[model samples]
Target chain A: MVASSTARTGAGGQTLVVDLAYPPDPGRAPFTRADLVVTGVDHSGTSYEVRLYLDNPGADIDTPRDPEAGYAGRYTVFGHGGCYGDEGHCEVPEAAGDPTDVRPVHQLTPLDTFVTVTDALRRVLDRDGRLSTVTMVPVSLTPRRSDRSPAPELLEFADLSLHTYLAATDLDVPTPG
Target chain B: MGVRRSAASLSVAELTDLRDAFTALYGISDDRGYAFLAGVHGLPLPQYCKHGSILFLPWHRAYLYFMERAMIDALRRSRDDPAAAVSLPWWDWSSAAAHADGGGLPPGWLAPADGGANALASGPMTLGDADLEQVRTNLPGAVTDGADPVTVRDPDTPDQLPKATTVNRALSATSFTEFSQIVEGIHNGVHGWVGGAMSAVPIAAYDPIFWSHHAMIDRLWYLWQLSPQGADPSAALLDTALPPWPMTVRQTLSVPNLGYDYAAQVVG
Candidate 1:
């Protein structure tokens, strides 16, 4: 499903600030891993990076990329720059109209990106049982030569959600045969 | 069929063969040349390599196969022993050996050769007029500044590499889509962690280490396929063609059928 949220980047790039509601159930055991599940990332434009931080909204390209500064992690998008084909050629393919139809999805279809912020998440939780926010700063890279006059949209995505997983139980690990 | 061993397991003789193979390919500036093959992934007009897509795994599998065959052929032509060529060695980033230093890159990958430059560490990039023009116009200032452009790497600390738990988490995924997304996300992190040209798609392949890093990703997928919970992509997706290569997704499913297999594929 396509997410509705999208962030269009500007000259210095746009920073996405999200207020997170997490720690679903206090009764459950602590999470072993925390992943920032970014869904439906739009990479049809220039390649770029999105730096993730726990609570540092002011984080930018110059910000110290370390755990002490709330730096969680980052991921890069090797984009297509822009469609080089005829009109509609680069458009994301719509779902097959008929279930009987048998064709693979388009190669340019939007995909999900995940960044594991386990250490960062744990630090926030340990300090104040409840974690509150996440900051994602988008940094734009070079665009297609023809469209270089004005900066192009560098970042766009469908959704942002926090997914936490519990530690593996004894049953999950297999015993030696 | 030859077995692709981990970079850490390669013998001194095997390392010499790989270095020789790459050195031979470096001279040839044609389609079979290292620069040309690297360009097929990104840079110039068409970047055929699949990223952030379902075809990511299969496409790279085919690309690796193509490059290995080219390397083998080059070795056969250059040396007296036709068997001198060795299967490409993969950098097993998830192993303890890789986590030993601040950065896990194999010594051979970054080590100098003899008293000269190391082909594996870096190589010259010879882009055609058209490719060079594209770089100048669109990808300004991306290449290294020097008399000649060469592939470069600015890697991050070992802590930045994906942890073993993250890889195991990806392997536990039941569906191909979920598996692809998680693995690709990990793949993207490595690229970013490597930094410099490796971080960018346009010139990433030019770096020789790009091959080993990718082999690790491909190996993980192979392990996943062997797991009981693993399943192939949907029928329609399997039948789809991976562009720029004749092979389909179904064709890339079997590693042995492709004439190679990983030496140690025991999943953690």
Candidate 2:
């Protein structure tokens, strides 16, 4: 398996603080790059936007158009049924949507984006030597539902799935070769 | 006004008698017991079940609710009939401590025999330390050591299990906001799939109380759905897929087709 490594260093007496924003309540929805705020110390000590991209594909609700569209499509349907309606509009039933298409062609925030951003941050910190602590804040990205209402906020499930995803980035492991 | 009997007041014998009546009503026998029981629990047999699926919570809740309702109905029927010979018995786990302590005749308690030596009897006979260890490791924060506080009582009885007592206390002590917080703590990480397609996780079958615990969990989910605070947003998202066989919500919602119904008042 191919492994990737990155590091950031603290420069000239300044401490590098990595604040990872997460939703205060994780059960509401998942955090995405769109919900991120990455600021780090540059050479002049000014906070700059450290471009963040996760290693996973962009976050898209997986609505499969075909048989092979797989697990993502199923999750999309389930989530769709769960949050189909808005304040005034009635929720759409799963059957009301088009069939024969196993997957829906919706824009998705890839899981890898988080990994990529974390990798980049690690590399920068390793290079700078001013790195201090890393903090993660879970935040919510709006869902592209028909209602266009704000996505409900979420609290993270206290499970290994998300933790493992974050750990892979923290450790700077490459996508397994 | 007439006094009402709640699930919280059933005895173990009453619960067992109800189980038998339901089994008879459905023509269930030992040969097809698992499938019948699975139906009672709103699950397809393991052979039809997918590994690492999200159906765990909803499916099991449906199953237990069916059982609770069946038991409740049977008790009411028995109360109205002079010919009714069997009464509901409650397996009060809190009383187990006193029973162990040599206290005479723990109240609202019944011996395991009333269950007719079924799979649930194994729960009292063996501890299965290894299984308990796995359950502990996977599900941290389980109350361990002091006494076997996990009670399996007929839903119609008020016999209190220690764990149920604690849960009741927590629910009663907290304001609605605090209760919501407490529930959230328990509900977190609750949605996940365990085991792969090839391997089966036997945790569901480890004890008979697994059904009841899951029933309680489902009840919490129902309550959460109705809470003014809002349903768990994460729950709104489907992170998993339906199995290959095409199924619709209509197919799933029908009780006779599924072979059971939710207790009349429980869902309300």
| Structural similarity to truth (TM-score) of each candidate | 0.77, 0.32
Predictions in order: chain A TM-score: 0.76, 0.21
lDDT of 1 by residue, B165-233 (tens): 667877887688878887887787677556556656666788888888888898989999999867898
Q: What is candidate 2's TM-score for chain A?
A: 0.21
Q: If you assessed candidate 1 against the hidden native complex, which CAPRI class would it receive?
A: incorrect
Tell me the tens digit of each residue's lDDT in model 2 across A22-62.
22233223211111211111111100111122221222222
> What value does DockQ give for candidate 2?
0.02
Q: Tell me the TM-score of chain B in each candidate.
A: 0.92, 0.39
Report model 2's TM-score to 2 decimal places. Answer: 0.32
DockQ of each: 0.21, 0.02
Show model 2 residue runs off by greater than 4 Å.
A1-177, B1-8, B16-27, B30-32, B39-56, B65-119, B123-206, B231-268
Worst 10 residues of 2 chain A by lDDT: A71-80
Residue by residue across A1-177, what tens digits does model 1's lDDT show? 112133333224456666665564444355666678887888776566777777666666667778766788776676654554467867877786898976556546887887667778787777767666677777654422222222225657778888767755211221100
